[model samples]
Target: MSKGTRRLAAGLMVSAGLMGGVVVGTQPAAAYPSNCHYGISSLGTVSAWCAGGSGSVRAVAGCEWFGWWTTAYGNWVNVNQGASHVSCPWPYGVRWGGFNARD
Candidate 1:
């Protein structure tokens, strides 16, 4: 191949690599469920028993948000009863919620 053609191919390959697999979509994609946010306050309420004894356990019902659901029926949680850290897992790639339980 001509030197100029080879250089152009190499430049194109480098540009593709720099893009980091991001595709420029012509239309904007739909947003996540209108309600879910990542925080304890966002997770309205949960039962005390379901809150777990003292480690990183799953959250109880009503303590999560999913795909516009005011309350997530089934959501996993990571609760640290003593240290002051809590985490909520969201399905479908939704945002997870974390909290300072001790605080």
Candidate 2:
């Protein structure tokens, strides 16, 4: 065969191999439900729990206002107002009604 023909065939084979590698060599995508984010200038909430409701883990629901943040309860937390919340795995130590926010 001509040199150009051989080179073209080789190039196609390499490309096919590369595509196959991209398809077959990749690991499955992981699911991240908890490690979540809202968006720029948006509101978000997440929860962290302890085994027996005896740990003091502050899981924050955050609100971003252009760049700043605050608690959901309109308390100047740090940046903007947040709509965050909390949850206890065993429902023993954590209390209800606390985090609030304003527009």
Candidate 3:
């Protein structure tokens, strides 16, 4: 290859590497916790953590549930009675008690 072509190629590779690093570093580093972590609330409601926060929501017995939802900003979005036992992505799994529970 010509000297000019070799230098240009090397510069392009370095630029690509730096750009890749910046892109990866700027991405949001969020992940769902390993478990739903069900617990009793102050109101005596049997609930589990929504996806990524500490908020609780009442789970319906005998319904598959995704108790809480993690918002875009990595916060818990609590659910209400009207929201419980609703058709979710994986179907609500026996919400409250641990009866073949799933989400």
Report the lDDT of model 1 for residue 40: 41
Model 2 TM-score (2 dp): 0.30
Candidate ranking under lDDT, highest first, comes to 3, 2, 1
Model 3 stretches astray by more than 4 angstroms: 13-26, 34-36, 39-45, 50-60, 63-103
True-structure lDDT of candidate 3:
0.41
Give one digit per residue, the lDDT tens place, for model 3 in 1-103: 9999999999999999999999888955444333454543443334444444323343433333355531111112352212222222333333333211222
lDDT of 2 by residue, 1-103 (tens): 9999999999999999999999999986533223222222212324432222111223444444444544432222211223234433322232222332211
After TM-score superposition, what is the CA distance of residue 45 in candidate 1 from its true location, in Å? 14
> Candidate 2 vs candidate 3: which has greater lDDT?
3
* Best lDDT among the predictions, by candidate number: 3
Lowest-sum lDDT 10-residue window in model 2: 35-44
Off by over 4 Å in 2: 31-103
What lDDT does each candidate get?
0.38, 0.39, 0.41
Model 1 / residue 89 / CA error / Å: 27
